[model samples]
Target: MFTGIVEEIGTVEAVEPGTDANGVVTDARLRVRGPLVTSDARPGDSIAVSGVCLTVTDLPGDGTFTADVMPETLRRTALGELGTGGRVNLERALAVGGRYGGHVVQGHVDGVGTVLSRTPGPRWDEVEIGLDPALARYVAEKGSITVSGVSLTVTRVGDDSFGVSLIPTTLAVTTLGSLAPGARVNLEVDVLAKYTERLLATAGSAGTAR
Candidate 1:
């Protein structure tokens, strides 16, 4: 589990693809260079890399760690799109007794969204993301959403777009700082909203059946 609060912005050191005996592509091994996260990392631990929870396979003891990316994970998240030296938002798993600064995050990417617009400010910038119409129902104004592993509030929502404000700190610390229009990003909607919608739908179905 994570809180969606980015601890540090890490760099993608390497993405090595593995192949099967038949020469078919199997999976990819990712090595991320994060001085802060790797300082305390260990094998078998979980790290949220760009909003995808990956198990730490090798610490390497060099301010970098390795994680295996399966084919299914590659298909479902934006991590596969990364290349060497790409910027990525990183957050360590929520520790016991830690303050919950951001909303609940599972490090599971629900889908991919594209940047639509960016309105810059002296101190902050408002970003609009074009999401799939199906995900609009899960987004609400003033609610929280995870974008590329950064926790932010939705300032507005539309049929296929939502807006978020990035403060100066966020711009300096995370990949969102350099996000441009048309760039793809990983998106995870509020889990509470999804659960509420599910319960309401189930109740409505039971009422209709009675």
Candidate 2:
């Protein structure tokens, strides 16, 4: 599990084939090895690579690690569009006694959203993302949402979009600063809201059956 807090901005160094002889172009395989992320890493350790929870498959020397990207993961989220030299938000799993600065984030991206607008202001910038209709219900004004592994509060919600305020610190530390309109981003809504919705729906159905 993660806290939706970005630890570092890492770059995709290389992408290689996952197989040798039975070489079929499946999903895009990648090896995103970066410093500060693999300082104490090992195999099976969970790391949020741009809001996607990927396990460490291999650990090469000099702070380098590998993880596989399947076709389903590629199509479901925005990790497929990454190429060599692309910057990505990275965060390690929450430790047992670590401070929970951000909300609970499973690092499982629910869907991909498109960047609608990024308006720069005097103090901060307001970023609007065109979210999916299905996920729109979970987003509310002042609710927390993880965009590309960075936890941000929704300042406003429209019919199919939501806005977030980004301070100068956030802009300098995360990949969101470089995002342009129409770029795709991974989104993970608040998990607790989904459970609440399910319970309410189930109770309503049960009551009507009487």
TM-scores for all candidates: the values are 0.95, 0.94
Number of the top-ranking candidate, with lDDT as the measure: 1
Each candidate's root-mean-square deviation in Å? 1.4, 2.0
- Give the Å error, residue 179, model 2: 0.8
Task: Point out where model 2 deviates above 4 Å.
Answer: 17-25
Off by over 4 Å in 1: 20-26
137-170 in candidate 2: lDDT tens per residue? 9998999999999989999998799999998978
Q: What's the true lDDT of residue 46 in model 1?
A: 94
Model 1 global lDDT (CA atoms, 0 to 1): 0.92
- lDDT of candidate 2 at residue 80, scale 0 to 100: 75
* Candidate 2 local Cα displacement, residue 127, angstroms: 0.7
- The best candidate in terms of TM-score: 1
